[model samples]
Target: MIVRIMGEGQVTLDDTSVIELNTLDDELLATIQADDEEGFRRTLGALLDGVRRMGTPLPDDTLEPSELILPASDATLDEVKQMLSDDGLIPG
Candidate 1:
């Protein structure tokens, strides 16, 4: 799955679903700026859960050619962590 933050308060999902959460986004940024790690995580989780409830991914067979992709290459745990830390999402 791929997640992209389009702007301060908008999140675009695979170029299909565009969601606007201005209030939530502001709160998240505030928490992040204040170094409230738990608050940041909770808000992020809620945003993620909202998208998941929308059924972003239909099914494997329903995806278009551009949406389909191979799995990530095998890597050590630390390597994967570093990769994720460097980029929020892996390239498709």
Candidate 2:
């Protein structure tokens, strides 16, 4: 799966990484629901860090469509809330 971090380029992640991301996605959703700013920031940072660690960065020239689009690192809680869906940013 190709994941895109808004304001950043895309990264190619495998199934295992996707699964891990899904777990983090759940945490993110929970943080949002609980209105926990610290948790949200921590989970969001973890999610992004996981992607960077477990996935391969796509070349700038690559144009493949992304399967998931995550908020930018500096995104506000309200902005992240706006980005959430029933399945969250990364579907389980």
Candidate 3:
């Protein structure tokens, strides 16, 4: 799957990486529901970092559509909250 980090370019992630991302997404949802800004920040940073570490960076010239769009590392809880869907950012 192709994941896009807002303000960053796209990265290609395999199925295993997608599963990992889904787990992080769940944690993020929990933090949002709990209204824990610190947890949200930490989890969001981890999620973005995981993507950066596990995903293969796509070339800028690539035009493929992204399957998921994630918030930036510095994204505020409110900003990320607005981006969440019923299935979260990355659907299982």
Candidate 4:
């Protein structure tokens, strides 16, 4: 899975990481829905960190279509809220 962290390029996460990503996605979605800024920030950081850990970074020139596009590290709550989908950031 090619996951793109906005402003941070992309990473190719393995298929095995889907469930883990979904968990984080669901958590992030809840935080956003509840307007929990602290939770949102924390979850976003974890999610991004997870992606970076489980996936290999793609080269700058290897711009392939991303499977998921997450908010930037510095994204605001409102900014990330607009990026959410019914299934959250990481699709099932």
Candidate 5:
């Protein structure tokens, strides 16, 4: 799956990576629901950082549609909440 990080670039994740990200997404959603700003920021950073570390970067010239779009590292909780769906950012 290809995930686009706003202000960053697209990353291609394998199935195992997706599953792992899903776990982080679940934790992120929980933090959001609980209105834990610190937790949200920490988890969001970890999740985005994990994607950056684990996924392969897609070339700038590549035009493949992204399966998911994540907020930037500086995104506020409200901004991320707006982007969330029933499945969160990364669906399992």
Candidate 6:
């Protein structure tokens, strides 16, 4: 799930979860809201890119959804569990 925040006050999740800012999201939200457009874009791009890289490997336990994220639609608490199931790049 790729989460992106734009300079025009928009939040896009998985290319569908698009919404205007109603309130803050997290520490990330604070950063996005406070920084200049270019700076925000660069930082958010880096963070989002890092998360996208996490799904490079297929999980060993394919039957268990909990075991891997597999490019899912939403952010669940099982994220780390999912990443851990990957054959490459153990979750930190």
Superior by TM-score: candidate 3 or candidate 6: 3
Candidate 4's residue-wise lDDT over 1-92, tens digit each?
88899888999987888677888888888888899999989998999889988989999988999879888989989887666644456442
Q: Report lDDT (CA) for all predictions.
A: 0.42, 0.87, 0.84, 0.84, 0.86, 0.32
What TM-score does prediction 6 earn?
0.29
User: Candidate 2, residue 85: CA error in Å?
Assistant: 5.6
| TM-score for candidate 5 | 0.88
- TM-score of each model, paired residue for residue: 0.41, 0.89, 0.87, 0.89, 0.88, 0.29
**1-92: candidate 2 lDDT, tens digit per residue:** 99999899999999988887888989988888899999999999999999999989999988788889888999988888776744466553
Higher-ranked by TM-score: 4 or 5:
4
RMSD of each: 9.2, 2.1, 2.2, 2.4, 2.3, 14.2
lDDT for position 41 in model 5: 95
On TM-score, the leading prediction is 2
Kindly report which residue pairs in candidate 1 clash with one another: none
Better of 1 and 5 by lDDT: 5
lDDT of 3 by residue, 7-59 (tens): 89999999998887888888987898899999988988999999999999999
Clashes of 2: 0
How big is the positional error of residue 92 in model 2, measured in Å on the Cα after superposition? 6.8
Clashes per model (N, Cα, C within 3 A): 0, 0, 0, 0, 0, 1
Give the winner by lDDT: 2
* TM-score computed on alpha carbons, candidate 1: 0.41
